[model samples]
Target chain A: MFQVNADVIAKEEVIPGVFSLTIVSPVISENAKPGQFVHIACNQGGNFILRRPFSIHRIVPGKAFEILFRVVGRGTEALSRVKVYDILDVIGPLGNGFKYSERITSALLVAGGLGLAPLLYLAEELTNEQVKFYPMLGAQTKTKLLRYIDFKRIGKKTYVATDDGSSGHNGTVADLLNRTIHYIRPEIIYACGPEPMLRKVAQTADEFGVKCQVSLETKMACGVGVCLGCACVTRQGYKMVCKDGPVFDARDIIWDKEEIEPTLLGGYRCETAKVSDPG
Target chain B: MKNPVMPASGTFGAGREYSEFIDLNCLGALVVKTVTLRPRDGNAPPRLYEVSSGMLNSIGLQNEGIDHFIEHDLPYLRQFDVPIIINIAGNTLEEYAQLCREIKGVEGISGIELNISCPNIKAGGIAFGASSRLAEQVTAAARYNTDLPLIVKLTPNVYNVSKIAQAVVYGGANAVSLINTLVGMSIDTNTFKPHLGNITGGLSGPAIKPVAVRMVWEVAQTVKVPIIGIGGINSTLDAIEFLLAGATAVAIGTANFVNPRVMIEIIDGIESFLRQRNMSDIRQIIGKVKV
Candidate 1:
């Protein structure tokens, strides 16, 4: 929960419109965990006041962490032009991260497009804990699939799925998971992606009797709990995604009309199907 | 006094949310989100859109209503010693009076901040504050309903903020909080549609700071009641600027989203500035800005 002016040590375009920034901030790096995120201030001047939130894509504990973001709107576009050594006011390692039981020996990591950000970090955490897992990367096409090479280096095998049959499987990633779950028999499922894909994954996981944790996204003003802009309806009540979770149990989300109100992306197109993903 | 630093209503939900990151007691006061007469789901999604130096939000005053606040939120807030100013808004004057009456005997509440100018909603929001007569009517109605201190939170969207401020004071408001979010909107050029689902929202953040300071200064000269300056106050310097412009206190709104510890930081900064100046009290600097 510390706010620091992090020095951007490295910045690269992971893919067209998508960026990865490696920041030097020991406090945040040391405190951050998988599935947690950082809310970054875009610029100092009045033009970009709101801080944009990004999941911690990766971390190098006690030294620095990485944030992966897509150039969606003004904030991300402004962030894309930031050069190395620029200071970013970042407050985070925020929200509760993914939760898994110690007894779970086998896990499945699922991601949709840029949604792969947080799960990449979670995969590393699971690796360190000796939890055997497989990574499933999904995109609209082969070119959109991100970090497959990276995932292969970490997991037993990185499964690829594409909506256009441009890569591995020809259907949605959740369909691929549904087909493979019987063979893998994973004890738990962890996912981060668009809501529809997440919902599908949650359903499939339930059908297989496996526990599932998901990282959710919403338009947030304050990434801390103060602003209720990012409220998500749960079985209990409206929960602040910035505070209660950016990560939550799939079963807890209502996914009904009440919950559906805040999840509206307006006219923003789905980034997965539209954005170009690098294989 | 604990350097007048409080969370602006709507920006700080129930006190429980930020309690983990901030000690509630450290603030001069805590202003909860607007509580209407009944539970409100608020506006549709796409509730927020970032603008030049701030963001526009049409949260539509969403809350669990007054009953839920009294039952669930009040207990949690009562644990903290900080003065609680419950911000209430209504679709009508009766609703405002009813809310004041309902909250009158609440154990932990120190005052009620009548929300006369919430710009997001389609109904009673900014409409009340846009006109001096309606603003006075609502203030008088709420004032008659309770014996508690009444603070009318004014909207900056109006042409004459000072005129509205004076009217509310004449109607029996003990104090006034200036510059609720200015009404603004954005467009999604790609889709050729308005950015916010509600079509418009109240704009807050650093961009609104100048407008707020000007309004506070104007209202200060027009009315003798204390003014709680709100809008775009992110640091101690901004708070001091407001105080110097004639605000007795300042509320942190959009800045709370950027930094949870902003109010505490502002409080610490004010004390430092006052101590450095060898001023014995903060009042010496209030409205001290020289032409």
Candidate 2:
């Protein structure tokens, strides 16, 4: 892991409140792998103490990367106020990254809401590696839906599900997976999103007996493994989400922990994952 | 110890998680989380919540029990050149003695830090540290079982922290580390619910530094034993503040979360500061705060 002062190369409010911040950090951008994340310091000390952890949304080649986030709290709010010239203190290329084998030829990319953040990089990598992938995106509505056409550009086929029928299937994305897993015949499945949606996706993967790798999100203190603050249970026992994995094998995850209250977006009922093309 | 830069108990796990980020041998000491007599499941989800200038945590000292520490965690730590101090807790008074006896027989262990101030657990945490009588009793129990350097960690939740420090000193504690996270709470404005799963947690970070420094200065005057200052120490300036306030050593707790190399940085910074002051020994500055 490396800590560096990344200059804000560009900023775009992809949609109101949610932002896509491109930053210049040669060391971190070059080393960051698919599914790994960067912890960004929100402010210079006062009021906001902990650095917020963000998924390595996309790597801009050798010396830049983008992180997508919404201004939900003070930290993000502080981050949002920074301009193009601002410098962000970032520590990254952290936790374990998603694993892919040379033999795998086809795969399914599943994401729920902001869960789409980590998978776009995975999709781009699979494309580069000569693996065909079917990308599935889900959200609460059309506006909240992360509309990225690049998934279709790089993917063999793209699928979407939203709760409001604002854009693909008018149901949960897991339901879409259940209905279409056979047609896709993917050799591997990769996912990221709210815990509730991930739980549902795990069920679908279990029924089909496909190997699924999931990137989890939790309220973390130290982005590193030290705090044991971001605990996720597996068959083995409690594991630090930041260390043992922000990514884990689908079958090994034990969700017996109490149901985390619905997230602003992650908390979507199973019905939200279905997305339709805005076109 | 080369310097006072150490990871506070529970903040830095058994030292394996950070092996990739930092060299373990560079630390002044390595203090592991509290070892219990039995395996603990710990608290539920939402165990952490970020607040203004700090964070609240309720991990509840989750551990695989003393057997795992002695057989598994200890050997891994001995690889590092740093001294290994095990922070231990018990559900009851006798359990403290038993734990000390068990660790006393173990090899490669340097010292035992009695954690009588964990706010999250129901038994034996904070309860003992909150009362001078119980604090002294727990210290005496551990001191009787082992001749190893005994350090009693105190909580700041009490009315008179100095009295408790004096009691532990009288009870045979060789050193004392003060202020464990102050008990705190956070409530979400929208849902009108508590932020932490446990409803309350121990607050740590820059937010608690002033309070920690005050308590350190207070306890330093009352007890002659070495005082290991812990609370909101993130930088060289913070460490120097604690040292000037009469701390013999300082542990980096919440600050380690922000920068993995923080302890190393602080260690380097203190050397520079002392060099600039033309001070040859760290003791020259320790407890030398001008009145």
| Highest TM-score against the true fold, candidate | 2
- Candidate 1 docking band: acceptable
Please state the CAPRI-style docking class of candidate 2.
acceptable
| lDDT (10s digit) by residue, model 1, range B6-85 | 98998888877678678888999998998888777666666788888888888777777899999999999999988998
Clash number for model 2?
A: 12
Error of 1 at B199 (Å): 2.2
DockQ (Cα-based) per candidate?
0.28, 0.28
On residues A172-207, what C-alpha lDDT tens digit does candidate 2 reach at each position?
788788899987878889999988889888888888
Q: TM-score of each model's B chain?
A: 0.98, 0.99
- Candidate 1 local distance difference test against the native: 0.86
Query: Interface RMSD for every prediction, one decimal?
Result: 6.5, 8.2
